[model samples]
Target: MQNNKRRLVRHELNASIDVWDAQSDEHLGRLANIHAQGLMLLSDAPLVEERLYSLRLTLPQSLVGAGELTLAVDCLWVKSSEDESRHWAGCHIIDISDQGLAVVELLISRLR
Candidate 1:
């Protein structure tokens, strides 16, 4: 059963885009889907629920005119994939700059 409680629709990317931990610069995971208010990540490990994270999204320069965007996000939930080889995390964007938001909007539009 799938939960359909999200307010904003998320767009899945065809290309690979990596998400990283901004402070540690560690490669956290790949962006599974994204929207203006939130994003989902596919990682090797599960993220702690209800914890805040500073993440860096690396985007193609041609798509956003910039290389990366930093965001503060709160992990809402996490679940292990059925195969148990990966984890999916749902996170809500808590903070972002106006420019970063613009880039996100643009990316969503292009994805659509």
Candidate 2:
């Protein structure tokens, strides 16, 4: 049997947010779901596995008070969906600033 070992509750989300590589400032993809620990990202191409990426997730004005949230994330896995038109990547967040953490908490509360 498999164990459900998620530490944080993951909220299913459909909100669209632009994602960028924090170091190079390159646009990576769109964010699909968010949790306190990590996020699921959807992209046109697969990201390199086990790579650490500094990400900037631009939150919607309606959702997160019109600002971008900065985070350092470790890519955990990548897989192609059934449609094969896009790729999904799971990432573990390594760091978030104080203000960003506050915003994320508020967002999580609202989402819950």
Candidate 3:
């Protein structure tokens, strides 16, 4: 088995938060799922390969509030062969602030 993340864990729907387009930036789609290292987002928009982008994962229901948590990430890969017309962007968080890490951990814990 290969572990690409420092501590990867799957988060259930209860723990999952909705991420949005901070700048109304054009993205392929909304975030579908997240792990310790990164997340997968589905979008109908087109994106350049291997581009780095900033995203804000909103914690509207959580104690973290509806604030924006900035994440610097690069596209690890993209899948467009699915039956759905939308494409999926597989990303890697290049940098995550301490707060971001805590939030991710909390989300993971909720899954357990």
Best by TM-score: 1
Per-residue CA lDDT of model 2 for 1-112, tens digit only, reads 6365778877665566789998998888988777888888999888889999999888778776657888999998898889888999989889988888787777666654
lDDT (10s digit) by residue, model 1, range 16-71 = 88999999898999999999899999999788999999999999878976899999
- Per-residue lDDT of 1-112 in model 3, one digit per residue for the tens? 6455536654444544555555665333565777778877767764456988777776646456646577878887776755757777778888888888887776666643
TM-score of each: 0.93, 0.84, 0.71
TM-score of 3: 0.71
Q: Each model's C-alpha lDDT? A: 0.91, 0.83, 0.67
RMSD of 3: 3.6
Clashes of 1: 0
- True-vs-predicted CA distance for residue 83, candidate 3, Å: 4.6
Clashes of each: 0, 0, 4
| Model 2 quality (TM-score) | 0.84
Error of 2 at 54 (Å): 0.6
Q: Sort by TM-score, best first: what order?
A: 1, 2, 3
- Give the C-alpha lDDT of model 1: 0.91
Off by over 4 Å in 2: 1-4, 63-66
Q: For each candidate, C-alpha RMSD in Å? A: 1.2, 2.2, 3.6
